[model samples]
Target: MSLALPLQRTEVLVIGAGPAGSAAARQLARAGFDVLLVDQQPQGRDKICGDGLIPDAHKALARLGLLEQVMALAQPVSHVGCIAPRGGRIDVPGELAVLPRRELDNLLCQAAQDAGARFLAPARFEKPLVNEQGRVCGAQVRIGDDVHEIACDWLLLATGAVPKALIAAEMCERHTPSGVALRGYVHAPSMVGRIKAMEVVWNKAVRPGYGWIFPAPNDCFNIGVGVTDSHKAVSGKGSKKELNLRAIFDAFCANYEPAAALMREGKLLGELKGAPLRCTLDGARWSRPGLLVTGEAAGSTYSFTGEGIGKAMETGMLAADAIIQGKAKQWNDAQLREAYEQSLRALKPKFDLYQRANRVNAAPWLADLLIWRAKRSPRLLARMSGVLRETSNPGNLVSLKGFSRLFLE
Candidate 1:
């Protein structure tokens, strides 16, 4: 991963072809900027995720003009099933769907390409090229054996939760991940009808995280357990975490009847895979001179639900919009970077509220209370649906006052 190479040029060099990168690349390319999207992996690579596309994700896809195309290939869901520790449940209706990341990311990348962005697969980003003033001017990437230095006016880092590329670019603030998760696919037409909604289970066994069983395409269910708050301490001593994701996943299937039934009846489509999560949007510097961080690289995933897809795309487009406006207004580098930081800062309050909501995952009894109340109160269920849709502040549901009011309201 050395840096010496030829001087290929583009206005934008987008590293990591995830939702964030592709979204940014597509927008910038469509706006007439020369953009290139690069990924370490080739197309068709599977990304570990729960695969549940909620209302916010649907909205983002619609903004990108890919909603209909994506839904055509996705497994439509009626509602999200919430399961509590004691097995009590509630179904909160919302616009939801599930499609494996293998297809979702590929579709996004293809959309970016169709929108006129150059794409290079198996192209690994080595490091950023900085000018004399320390502003990132371009990047050096390794494609096969050759190293090529591609110059760009702006660089968008969308490298997901991995810290290596962030470290190379000197944009990473926290080396440790905010969380970790394990994902697996199970194929069972019999279980498909049985588990109709996107089922999310919270129990003491999976505290600080949760388990999900969502129907994916081709009679498969995407099943996984995510330790969303594992990066922090249970008490106040340290934030460093020592977790066994596999053990927790096993316990989830053992303790939850639906998960157990799915495991018993379905054929596990593949061996389980794990991925790191950066949540609460605090793990990285959002922007510096001539560079911006997007997606999980900027902590787009929610600490409460481990859902990052929509937020990633939203942040990516936000970053692109910043650059697009900066150029139109002829803003200085400092002004442009400050604007991006301000935009990211505006998202902080919501992310903090989501972190507060993570308490439900840490405390199983709290989930039970919410489920109990939600089943009894239509108002509570609507609020839960609102939270999923990103229209309601999660704090309202997790705060003590909100819980107490649930019974009376």
Candidate 2:
């Protein structure tokens, strides 16, 4: 039976109830805005991701006042173990945590509810609704078999990488700077001794990408592989032209010693699944009048590590801040635009640093050399660690000046 919903109105309509939407909704609601958060899933669902929370993620959660809740559910990790193509390993010290997205997303949504945001689950976004002036004023959504319209003063899209809604709304022609990534869980309690931290492995075949084994709560490990869209295009001809990320992941487990060791004893928890990783901070629109795009939908993932959760949440909060600031002064759309763009500018330095890391990954030899250098250079290792923590930029490690200071000096 089609259950029709009544006409709904909200000060802010946040589409997608992931970290980005939930965070934005929580902030805006707490600040006295009537926020409506929606998602297609009836209950919080698991997503294909490493699910590791580095220091920056911690900061974003803390800002949303849900850090303590997340920390309680996460498995603590203190270091990152990086493996070069030739089997050389380097461990960088930092605080890290991993929690399944199923749990994390639910907790974030509950937090948003507690802060006064109304939630509409199992509601799928159809498209953006624009005013006569071509300004987006709200969204069209479908719940079950009934379609409904949600009118809002502002619309925030936290839809994450794919850009289906973005394209439907005429926000972009298509997604640019995208990559394919695969992830799955494995139950390996006995292998915990060898896997004490997040492990990242690089192989010659998976240039411009890498494989990861992140320890999760319980005896599970999130294992995955990723490769950029550009890398896949130039990979080869014929059937080889299409890059099989799963095959790449399987080959990585077979070749990488640490990963191989775990797979031997660990049982697969579920089927491995893959998705498009929307990265590289380019060619995505952030705002169009009453609407704003935050999170991966706005290209917030760091190209260097393919880490999106933290940046995603950060962009959400930034959008909320801009909205709150504009509301205070009753600013016009032009003013809101300025505030939002100003907020996005804060990420430029970090994004630039990630771009540099992308270049390093393109040249495997240089990245491997840097990994080797980190094994012997404490200063370099510390700086590398700081990049993950958001205290240092990745560019500092690969820049000519930084290279000279570390190796030549």
Candidate 3:
């Protein structure tokens, strides 16, 4: 028997209680808005991810005043060791943090609830509720066979890259192919090997996509590979047998000397899982009437590195800021759309530059040369690391002037 509850109404309805949704709801609730945050899974569910938070992510956490919380639960990563095709490598100094996604997501969601947002878990989103004029007014959700209509003055979609949510909300016709990645964890203490830096490997084996061995808390490591769908078109590598990310990951783990030696003793923690990555935000409609889309669903993931956590949270904050401020000014849908679009436009520089860098790195030779040059110059290496931290501009890293200074100067 379903329990009859009062009609669910909120000033803001946030779908998908991941980092993005939780962050947005937290901010809105802090501003005294009645926000409803919902997710498909219960609290603290494991989310497949690299779990590495680069400097940019740290900045976002700091903005939310949760840096201390993350610091307490995270493994410190102080440098990045990037390997290029043909054995070119560089070690750049920086600060990064890693923790299990299960912990991180739950912490963020709990923070939201503490700030006054209402959270509903194990509630699956069915579709966006649209009014007669096609404006999103709320969401249709199901909680254990009892359907609920969550009416809201504003709706925000933070559903990550899930295609079902996108299609249900009419955000995208079909999921546009962007990037694919496979990752798994290994809990081998013997494999720790005093390696404190995050390792990125690029070789012929995983051309166009890169492999990473990131240290996790408790002496484990997260290993993964990411490949953009446009790799073949840009690299001019003619279509051949389709590359299986899992098979490639296995071959790399079995053949790559470092990874092979480590995995020989390390046990895989779980089945290797793969997911699609969204690389661009240009095609998505950010705001329509009363609805706003953020996170990976809006293609906020970085193109080169396939890191979306930081960008996802940033977009979430942007959406919340727009709504909070718009409500103050009593702005209509047109004004709200303008504010949200402009906020996204402000982020275009980084995304555009990252795309260019992605294309530049598609060529193994150029990547090799860049890494080789950085290895020889400490100052250049620091600059390269700054890009990962978002302190330096990515456009400069891929610019001819920057290359000359790092290589010829």
Candidate 4:
């Protein structure tokens, strides 16, 4: 079949209409740039995710004028319950929120549209359009049977982890690490009448990651297991080499006492869905002349909490700023590269610290010890929780004097 080629033009083109793409498109359009947002799936489509939004996400939503819509669609979670391998529990009190990705993404896309961004939903990005000088000019896309070539001075890639088009264009490298996420929806029968807390169950059997049960509204819950690729790589001793997140979940529900109780009262409501988790923080081929990358496509997803929505939004906002400034001043590659690098530099330290902390938690014994300590000391738990939640930096949690007082006093 001959591919029909249609032509269009815009000032800025955003690929992928997820949180990051929509956020950037909205910000850019608000700044008076003729922005076009494109996505493979139609509007109101669902993306697989943990569906839990932290406080930082709330702040981002507010900035995007999405807080009201999000609040209306989401349920507020007030606590996090941690369960250890030995059946020990640590309940940390905090404000958390949950919403399905379908609702959240739709809300964000709508906000972008409201801000004057044109959306091309159900459109697949075919490839990047390159000029004779080898610089990216824009993108070639397909909406159903019609192919369209959209030209822009700036191209922003917010295409999530599986950036197939970007990889195909040879604009970015792909690393198929063994990390996997097995997630499903479950009916929380036991917690139906009670205020539910987001839960994490840690065990050595589920090495390099923990199992989670996050509360959703309407008596439903999102439960999953995130296993590291390192664990999968090491487990290749036999036929059972691949990490079976479903098997892990079933085993936990069947064998682990607390988990068993929770499952016995709950109903498995959906099939287990799996997705690849990129573990590396290596940036994508971000810029070549007029193009840039944002969100997971640029490895902006935090290796620590696997949280990318907030970081994606933050980076998207910054990218919009850089693009606006770049366009106004006829900025060269050096200026744009400097701006992108500066943004990453400012954000990387916190992400690096979080990754280190995640490495610590991935160790079953270390996680057990930390939970034990947290259970024994509420103050320590609060400080640690603050660090994990990214509400405060780890350095500010305690000083030498405070550490001395924890034991010395």
Model 1 scores a C-alpha lDDT of 0.89
lDDT of 3 at 202: 76
Best by lDDT: 1
TM-scores for every predicted model: 0.96, 0.94, 0.93, 0.88
Comparison by lDDT, 1 against 4, better one: 1
Clashes of 2: 0
Scored by CA lDDT, what does every candidate get?
A: 0.89, 0.82, 0.80, 0.73
Clashing pairs in 4: none
Scored by lDDT, model 4 comes in at 0.73
Model 3: per-residue Cα lDDT over 1-409, one tens digit each:
1223336888998998877898899999999999988888988877767888988788888888899999899989888888877777787777788888889999999999999998887888899899999888988888888788888999898887766787778776335546778888888798776556788887777776788888898878888888765323323222323668887787667646677765777888978888777666744568788899898888888888888888888889999999988989988888988998898998988888888778644665767877878878777777787798786777677677877787664
Which model scores highest in TM-score? 1
What clash count goes with each model?
A: 0, 0, 0, 0
Model 4, position 331, has a per-residue lDDT of 83
Q: Candidate 2: lDDT over CA atoms?
A: 0.82
> lDDT per residue, candidate 4, 1-409, as tens digits?
1222377788999998888899999989988999888898888887767887876687778888788888888888877787777767777776578898888889888889899998887788888888998888888888889778999888888887775865766656554533557788778767664537777777876666677878787788887777653333333221224556777777666656655655667887768787755444453576667688887777676664566677777778878878878777888867976797688778877776656556533666655655676777877778767864676565432334444544531
In candidate 2, which residue pairs get closer than 3 Å at backbone N, Cα or C atoms, i.e. clash? none
